[model samples]
Target: MEVFEPFLAGIDNPDHRDRVEEIFNWVKTRFPNLMPKIAWNQPMFTDHDTFIIGFSVAKQHMAVAPEEAGIHRFSEEIVQAGYDHTKELMRIRWDRPMDFALLERMIEFNLLDKQDCSTFWRK
Candidate 1:
């Protein structure tokens, strides 16, 4: 997580900071091959130069951005997993459990769905 040290170090709230690190570690441990980077001022994971997902922390919730397509594709699953979402990002309330399984599905879907993508982001 050397690439993310700057961002992580900036998080002043211990609980918020710890949770963000937990989410980062979960993704890193689960998918060791994915590259970790700080982009758009948040933590993001990529594979073959294409973004798989991203995470951000706010006052009341953590935001998960799997990009727009991932959200659209997993809308129902996000709800079933007990999360709220916008067209571009999912909201995981700070008080709720981090659904790693749901995250895995979204990452897997993005990997498959964006296999042929020619850019880091979707058009």
Candidate 2:
């Protein structure tokens, strides 16, 4: 939670802050071993110093970025979950019930997929 305070403090809207906190807590609790930090002005989770996933807030959605490959791999599931996405990110509506299971899978996949990675970002 400490890693999130700085980012949360920057959000002026109470509702937005609460929404972001909910998502952050979900990720934190779901993957207790992942290290949390702020990077590129967003909340990112890392495993063995490599990025697993990240989240950011937008006007209409909470953007979930699992890099572009994850988005491509889970394209069908993402659409079925009622979210919008692009090559690098997914847009999750604040009012909708988040698909925690899917998020868990994505994180796990990322961890395993990038196990050999030596840096936070792919080269």
Error of 2 at 37 (Å): 0.8
Candidate 1's residue-wise lDDT over 25-94, tens digit each? 8889989989998877888999999999998888889999999999999999999989999999999998
TM-score of candidate 2 versus the correct structure, residues matched by position: 0.92
Per residue, candidate 2 scores C-alpha lDDT tens digits across 69-101 of: 899989999999999999999999878878989
Tell me the TM-score of each prediction against the true structure.
0.94, 0.92
Candidate whose TM-score is highest: 1
Off by over 4 Å in 1: none
- Alpha-carbon deviation at 92 in model 2, angstroms: 0.9
Q: Compute the lDDT of residue 97 as modeled in candidate 1.
A: 92
- Residue 112, model 1: lDDT of 93
